[model samples]
Target: MSMDVRDLGGRPVIIGAGIAGLMTALQLAPEPVLLLSRSPLGADASSMWAQGGLAASLGDDDDPALHLSDTLAAGDGLCDAQAARRIVYAAPAAIEYLARFGVRFDRTPAGALRLGLEAAHTRRRIVHARGDGSGREVMRALIAAVGSTPTIAVIEGFEARRLAMEDGRIAGVLASGPTGPAFLATARVVLATGGIGGLFHDSTNPLGSCGQGLALAAHAGAVLADLEFIQFHPTALDGPGRPMPLISEAVRGEGAVIVDETGRRFLDGVRGAELAPRDIVARAVWKHLADGHRVFLNVRERPGPEFARQFPTIASACKKAGIDPVRDLMPIRPAQHYHMGGVAVDGSGRTSVTGLWACGEVASTGLHGANRLASNSLTEAVVCARWVAESIAGTPAHRTKPAIASDRPSPDPTTVRPLLSRALGVLRDGEALKAAARALLPPAERKDAASDPAAVGLMIAIAALRRRESRGAHYRTDFPHHAAVARRSEITLEAALAAARELAPVLEGVT
Candidate 1:
């Protein structure tokens, strides 16, 4: 018996209810939006875990041009100038938009918004709420607003597995919920499915964020770019834990320092030391760890007593781990934090495939380039969400069609994680990447939603192998030198699969 696909009644359907998906749905109010969340909205989302706040030129000492310059510099030559400019210039307004939704930003004594500085920023322009609870506060406001909006119908605990296409255009999405599998028939499908952090063993992302969006888009023939550029954060709390706790960059901005076991600052030689670009800082921390030295983020000297008051979240997390930030040195290490690469989209968050749009971490909008500026992600999510909403609003919906459902078993994420972490983690070499490709590609044959992580993993490994140079977050130790020209890598799933098959001969006789 064929299960009838649930018709969304020509509504705009959004997958992954993070900051982007929620924001997009809210922006498209009165349009009857269908929003899907893998978990409850605000829970299991990177946006809700974001410690650092949104970056904006709201400070009197700052301006958009300065923000743009810092963004381009941090992007390491791949940032789209126009996109960066658009997001940066829209920062103040985006903040205002959030404020209107009842987001209570931390304010000064005079009732002015208090701004903080982060690494790579020229000015103190980061607008935070509840010190380190920016993501939580922002998400709280967005979730409340969403609940109040009658037009936005949220389906929690339902994960969108694959995008259904008809006649080379997006027809709807095939999703699996707690009940079983069902198809959602809608013309406009927006993917706000976050990043590929879950593919790594050590990541600051929820386990559910396993690059499903990337896989879904790629399977539907969307263009993916810069798959090699995974941003490993330098200060994930080093301990036995999955989805490691993050020590916000704002802690460093407040004058904390990274120190070795002997209290030696390893990043002293770097131009900005603790305040350098994340890639540089992460590499420095990684090398220190590889050298058998214990690395810790020392905040005792600076924000000692103020820690509990300013960053209640980090303070609470540290307390739970039996480490007091006011007295003990907090151990930290590099962990997979963000992906600078994802489903390629334009400024308006439109993917290569028609009727499919993307925003947030899932969509590579050429804003982050080779690396992302701290706190700029939230800004990009909001800006791009609004853009995607406006784009979808003006565009007419297409006729819904029945989607073909497949029951191919998903590749076990447990099996895929080790291969991806080994090959595509903080450091990479061609051999490990090739081996990972060999191991990951075979399982990618199961083209269902569950196999998207392996497929996305294969894409990253292959892309890393192809880009034989160190750039930004993608540091290939074998290719220690930067290429003469900086270029972005764009590939389709078909092309990556073809490349993987050609290397099959090398896989024989290897475990």
Candidate 2:
């Protein structure tokens, strides 16, 4: 496929239209930027579906140190202390930054910010907008801000398929749009392309979020960290939906309970009960479901009649499922939500690859180490967007030769979903991970539509297989205890493919 080369004249190109991408473009403003979105703004983004809001130390009783403590605890001993502290400390300011962008967060009648709560949080630090429609409100403001900014050029309906690299550095971005493939030549590229939830069968993220950013970075030889840690929300509205509707943890914070179909409070004896860190709760819910018992979020007696008023988005979803949150027992199940892994980056969001930076769910910034604290993901995105923009602004845009490319179609995660759901779900074992790695090898080696998603799955399988002990979101059933010494795992595409190749013969012979 012949490509049209569009020289951006050293203008920075930001990929993905989620909060991170929009905010990064806004931050770089007065200076020109090219923002590429696969879909229109507010669509196909996990950030647009975020209901829990941004976690900030804005409560009178709260402090950034306290927020950092909760974050470190949730991370299960693998969080980078420095990075976590920096982001958490900047969170309150980040909230203000959003407000400046015209995000009208929920405020009290007396004109004070009304904070909410979520699981694993020690304080009421969740700064939300429109109650449960936080993401919608936030995106609305950012989209408006991007539109009005004279320097940021928004290009919708463009999917970034590959990073044009030369001599181990970024040359340009090859993207597919309505007309066809176009290569935007520039030295700087920022990947804010969201999570890998679409690679799983049951997820709360948009189905389009199949880790495209990770695939691009990996193929460009960037290192990825903690690929095994995928957080499953304990209460996705249990029913049929392409991407399951999330029953926000804020509902549980508002006094909801998890019980069996028989109305027995199954998590009664668990520490922190229904409000424990996500990994623990997801495991318990997954186990209960595996035991042939139906689980439901018993909000009938707790949030009661006030449920709809506080969580309109979730309420509407429940209503669509033919259940009224004020009266009915809402069926619930664990679904893949946040991923605590991606292109490994430093404090400035600069990846190992030169001229390449990553922010949001696509970058493993060492903030959410093993598992993410509820609502912290948004805070990280907002705070890191500024840092990423600054880093890009300071770096010189080197000119490169016109990039050559074989245009490829957007990735479809269908083939890898079941494989991941079975081998890398809430419960996993070495044998299953090995089998999955072996199965994904050939597809990952190919250059077809399945290759990108398959490569991502293969990497995750290899990472999970290597991490023998249970830790946070990644649990190996065969090795159900945490190791004495905690460590973060990293893998490159080549290393992951090599690991899979080594395991294929051994697993094939055993099978």
Candidate 3:
């Protein structure tokens, strides 16, 4: 296929179509933006799969301080206080912003926003829409708004392959589409490419979300923070599904209980019980599953018949699996649900790399710390999009010359899933991590489709190996306790390669 290069006259290019990407483009408003999406509008984006609502301190009894308190406690000491405070405080405004963009949130009979509760939240502050279809509603409105806005150019069916760098800054995006390779020459770029759950066999993220943004940034000399802190949702509807259906924590907050096959409510003893922080619940569930038992979510008495009315999406999934939530026990297990780490960004969503910014799950803004509070991911994305847009709008887009990029095969995580699932799941240890790193080194250095996914997996393995203490989602069986002092971990591709090389001296090929 022939390569096509087009200059957008220094328009800031947003390389995603999720909430972060859509919100940034909308906020940039009359300013032109080249919005790219690998799949049709909301078809394969993780944002469209989000069931839990966006977190905002919208209730009368709830306050941003209270929200921040819950956030910090869930973060387990790794969240940057300033970022978490700013984002949570701005959460209410974000909800309003979404509403202004045509998102009609669930409202009370008194014409106020109806708030729901989630795990680790002290008060009911989750603002949902269309019941459990919050993400779908948000995406639908944003996609419609984007279509009507003439300034934003929507480009679907194209995937960003690489960031074309000129003098150590972004000059253009090398992307591949159905026709051929196309390079959009623009000085500024925003990455909102979602999460890395696809790297695990049992994950809740779309399979297309295999850390493409992380790989793109890492290759362009960007730093990624806390790569090992992967949040596994404890109650994913378990079956033979590749990307498991998330039995949202909202269901649990609504009174559903978790139990093992013997009809024992296993989490009864833990503080907050099924409502504990996700990492804790996931670990408990994982250990139970490892101990020759089957775990299930029992909504029989809690939501009962209202389960279908309150959470129709989940109810449909249950029906498909031949399990009635009002009668049968819904089989469940822990699955990789979210990533609390990605291209390390500051308060303004600016990465270490100039002319580049990240948002959504692909950017570690330090708000999530070690574990994400339920429903905080969407809140963070909506809250950070404004800041990202402001930073981009304020900066002048530098002129860039036409650029050329080699055609690279699309990334495939098929070879990476099992390796990551084994080494970096809910439980980890030094030996498994080291072995994963060594095993991933060869493919990471290769030029095949598995390279990018392997490279992301390798970095995660290295990060998991380096963190000696157990903190939040990153639980190392060998180091099952927190360090005396809490700290966040950061990594670059170079550092990860160096660590991998040390593990496999004379790595199979490229040293």
Instruction: Give TM per candidate.
Output: 0.96, 0.97, 0.98
Give the C-alpha lDDT of model 3: 0.92
Better of 1 and 2 by TM-score: 2
Q: Between candidates 2 and 3, name the one with more favorable lDDT.
A: 3
Each model's total of backbone clashes: 0, 0, 0
What lDDT, from 0 to 1, does candidate 2 have? 0.91
Which candidate ranks first by lDDT, i.e. highest?
3
| Ranking of all predicted structures according to lDDT, beginning with the best and ending with the worst | 3, 2, 1
- TM-score of structure candidate 3: 0.98
Candidate 3 stretches greater than 4 Å from native: 1-5, 505-511
For lDDT, candidate 1 versus 2, the one ahead is 2
Candidate 1, 212: how far from true, in Å? Answer: 0.5
Kindly list the per-residue Cα lDDT of model 1 for residues 1-511, writing each as its tens digit.
0123376678888998889999999999989889988787888898999999999999878899999999999999989899899999999999999999999999999999999989999899999998999999999999999999998888887777778888899888888877777789888999998987778899999887888889889989999988888899999999998889999999999999999999998788999999999999998898888989999999998887898899999998899899999999999999999988988888788999999998999888888989899999999999889899999999897668766554444434777999998888778899999898888877787654436778889998889999989989998989988899999999899999999998876456787
